[model samples]
Target: MAEFMTETEQSSPVVPHPGTTGERRGRAGGSDAGPYDGQEAAALLERTRTLVDPELRAALESLPGSLRRIALYHFGWQHADGTPARDNAGKAIRPALVLAAAAALGGPTAQAAAVRAAVAIELVHNFTLLHDDVMDRDTSRRHRPTVWSVFGDADAILAGDALQALALRLLAEDPHPASAPAAARLADCVVELCAGQHADTDMERRAPDEVTLDEVLAMSEAKTGALLGCACALGALYAGAGDEDVAALDGFGRQAGLAFQLIDDVIGIWGDPRHTGKPAGADLASRKKSLPVVAALSSGAPAAAELAALYAEPYVSGDAEGVVRTALAVERAGGRDWAQTEAADRMARAVQELSRAVPAPEAADGLLALAEFVTRRTG
Candidate 1:
């Protein structure tokens, strides 16, 4: 259910710890002194939207009428009343990773050839988002109401199913040698993602004390890391890379995805609603067993008991004080520190994995920048 938004209306920034990814990047060079930074990532994402949006739109346009309308609405291309709307689809990060991985390995030619695969990956991603919103009961995404909230659950689910089918169909109809393999890989990833989602929903029903930090971490990897890894692997396939290199790219993306999740979990608790498009302490209010929460629950801190007691009681509507206490308990129990430290470690591993495939710093810059942009998000 974690979605990466590139732009946010920031209230306050999340300052990185001394040895964290942001801090290291600063020491290596400031934005003016280095090519890999938020600006580079933003440019890459903008370029990716330009390349992939037309194909994505064409694919959606080919859908049958009712489904097309729902799909268009979900993607922010149209309103519920069928009026044209401004674009709010997303930042196109996953597709950008596809193109960047291809470019890193095999240059512009491979990047150009991987456009179809990029579209397919993006399709699969949006499909997940649609279903996740329904399952998570999230009211908003990308600063707007979610599809299920506006169009109802049945329409939202059917639209998501249609999108998944289109993703595979795009790959199946492609003439590239990598198409079949990419399709197979993507299908496997979908299965893993489903399993992860199941685990997440199941964990929500369990007592907080009954859920382990290890279990939550595993679920997060399956739900978030699997698709990101698949995206990079698809790009490598399109580039005709060797198995080891493809696997390395997959590892890189997976680590980065995990890092992104850790930061997202942190934001879910402490993030500003104006920037995140969600109410403050939404995760705590729902008692979601996020990474930080689980870590806090398992920390054996004195505040853990207080947190568990608070979580044991259902959150009453309008009880803002309860949410505040829960958040403070989590913070005092060391959840915040563990999550941030874990995120930095994951980013480091991501960089190491990226180097295994794209040894040249210049070649790896785009992927690194994207990874940094995601993990560094404060909202």
Candidate 2:
């Protein structure tokens, strides 16, 4: 793993945005900017919304009355100000990846059915998040109360169930012959997702000393990698891509997903609260066995000892500060450095696989650019 990190680390450099000016600010400054600043990432997100909203609406219309209303609310169809406006519901990064992959495979952006497949993938992603927040006891998401917090847990659970069903239904309803197989792949991905969640919960129950980096990586791949792979595979099939293209895209998605998770782990520890929509060291407070923390423990450093001590205590009032301190310890011990290098490696592999999958230079360039943006974005 260390060799892998060393080999891939230099493939991509994180260039500072021209707008940043290298200005350093206090913790709150990072997220004070609006979610949709006039940046390339925001522009891509806008394009995704235009492509996905119609299909999302159509899918919601097909749902039962209660489910449809809940889904609409979950997607921010109703405004935070209690008015009717389609706000920025979610980032739609995965759907953008799907659409880019399809385009790279010579599919038309106007293919309604392919767009529907993209919408299905986004819905499934959010569905898992809705349920995950409930299971993880997370109260906040996207800087607002989570669905499970706003509605009750039972309602959120039902919403998740309905969304999963809607994902398959959309796939099945597609006139394309490849849709069926794509739907099956999605189902398999969900199974893997559940398996990963179970593993995560089991790890949380075990002694901190018992965890290993390999186990953490396995769980991360299952939880995050599988759905990303499904997104790419679905896109390829919808584009009428060959089996080889689909397989290559699948590999790309897996590597990209791992990179995404690693960056997420980094943010979970040190992310600016405003941009991440969470407090710094949020994962530590939740006692999550994230990749960096696992790496620190496995490396057996002073930071690991501090983390072990922190983990040994029962939940108590005023422990959040202690958790943050322990998280800082992990960062000081080079765990964060290791994880960032790993993220860069995974991203390099994703780019390499995407290049192999699509020989056309223009199409391949777009996909590669999107991959780079995903890992490099600050918020």
Candidate 3:
């Protein structure tokens, strides 16, 4: 299991290159170091995306012109004004997970059959993102104006709906044996995602003190973990993995997803905007009930009381100092420390869950590396 040293470790950061085990260990600081082998991850990502990009483009082309334009801009396939561009699309993590899971279960040769599942998962992810930007009223994503901010909310909403339909259509139309269950699983995951988003929205409407750690964690799992789990499970199904193996893969993804969410919250507070492509202290400025914020408020410490006082009032969006203060308050209340520890523990647990499905170390290596990759970034 690859879990890196915490940012607080007070050591120089070293990004390990692809090389011998000794070289990897040296850069990672120990023989047992769990670091992301970037070359391996990059190659897998590029190859998988190369395989799926054309089909994904064709899927977008099938949409009506208005929607297609919106989708293309959103995907970074075109400039906001529809001029051609090569801006990077979103990180194709979910789809890569689909192929990695399939390779783990059925070997690399069998992964081609699972491409539809990968594409379906990516479409569903973007659907949630479009609706989420509208719901959150977020003006920016990946260094550009969010879809709803550029276009109207209704257009963004309709585009999200269309994308959701496209996901199901891909699954339903695929002739593979796993298509039916994959579609069902994707639909079920969407329901959970909506439920999580609802919980999140509901919490924002209430007093910050009224939100509990358990509630926030559950919401994180639903909103993020469900889709990731479904992505892995669909891959397993395509690989002809049995129910138990499929369930284990889902568990692996779910735990890793939770860890990813935790780190994302941390990044929201302390991340450099230049690196993260979001406003500095964005979550604190929005006063959204991110995991660490809720955890600090619920910690029952004096600092928790101080943090609650800040949250009892709304966060003004442009008040950089106030957001910084709120972040410090959360840290003082042990929320940041707790989240960091929990995220590390969860990443390790994810590897254990992965082992239950693919017992072979060779088969499990890529999945393990990807799981670590989730926690390796400041962004």
Candidate 4:
């Protein structure tokens, strides 16, 4: 639900260093040194796999016929080639965040249950991706044909439905006494996600002049921020964290989610096709009302006027060059600068929330590292 920056924007020539390395380090410096590199993300994924693979596998096994097989393929649990390759599926970042939050709350007796909760969060995330591809008519994902593109729209929809059900079922299986509350919170998050999606889709249908920055932010908070907050709160709940800690973690998650979405919007515009796996100016081609474009339009720049004019044209009539021109208009109008500043501010707020949380040393370190990694990631 959270929008990322356009990948093509990553290659934009506006190369002003947004923040000094020292400032960045200082922001993350309070915590003890922990793995912040991509490898650390990989390690976290491995840990999560060790904890949830059995349960995920059991859930998959219980599904009927081709539906089960398709879900496995969607998760990268099986290969398109049908060979047994255990590749890095997803980064599993959300689960890692959940675990770190729980661990920070002082070793919960139900660490495994928390891990299961993390898996549910990740599955729900992927489930959205599946449906998103269909709705967006995307052709590829994770360097492969999308389920809709390969198996047809019907199958993709069915798989997404099943995955959503699986996530709820997993949440229901939490062995801790706190599982019920956590499950309820997760369900509420799903409702928020739907609300966000409705806002986003509604925006798409409206005239560009009708959209507002406030609406965009609200949409992002619901679509992207809600689930992330749920992940953090669910972790704390599983660990029997006090209300204060849970609230702090929830604040941290909300800020982190906003930061993540801002960075993603930048990537959507400027990221390299090789790294991001999306075409350059893909958002512009789709005429997406992303944060940067929205900011530029709201700022009323000359280029913003041009962008609005282009967006007013029918998609069938819009050319690739038009898309590229419109994206550049956003950058020239200072949307990029505005987004970068907002991202830094959100990251700072997240750190402040983390500081207030008062997690244990190791868990705090990991959580801080994770936040830094999310804000700083290039791909």
Off by over 4 Å in 2: 1-41, 79-86, 109-113, 314-325, 377-379
Task: Write one digit per residue (lDDT tens) for candidate 1, span 167-223.
Answer: 999999999998998899999999989999999999988888889999999999999
For model 2, what is the error of residue 330's alpha carbon versus the real structure, in angstroms, after optimal superposition?
A: 1.3
Q: Mind sharing the TM-score for model 4? A: 0.84
Most accurate candidate by TM-score: 1
Number of the top candidate by lDDT?
Answer: 1
lDDT of model 2 at position 104: 74
User: lDDT of each model, Cα atoms only?
Assistant: 0.85, 0.72, 0.78, 0.72
lDDT of 3 by residue, 1-379 (tens): 0112222221111222222211221112223334554557667778878978998989999999999999998888888788877956666778888999999999866588999889999899999989999998878676668899988999899999999999999999999988998898899999999998898788889888777899989988998888778888988999999999999999988988888788778777776665555466888877778888888888888899888888778777577788888889999998887777667666666777787898887887777666666555543
For model 2, what is the alpha-carbon lDDT of residue 224? 85
TM-score of model 3 vs. true structure: 0.88
RMSD of each: 3.4, 7.0, 5.2, 5.0
Which is better, 1 or 2, measured by lDDT? 1
Poorest stretch of ten by lDDT in candidate 3 = 1-10
**Cα distance off (Å), candidate 2, residue 200:** 1.8
Q: Give the TM-score of candidate 1.
A: 0.91
Candidate order (lDDT): 1, 3, 4, 2
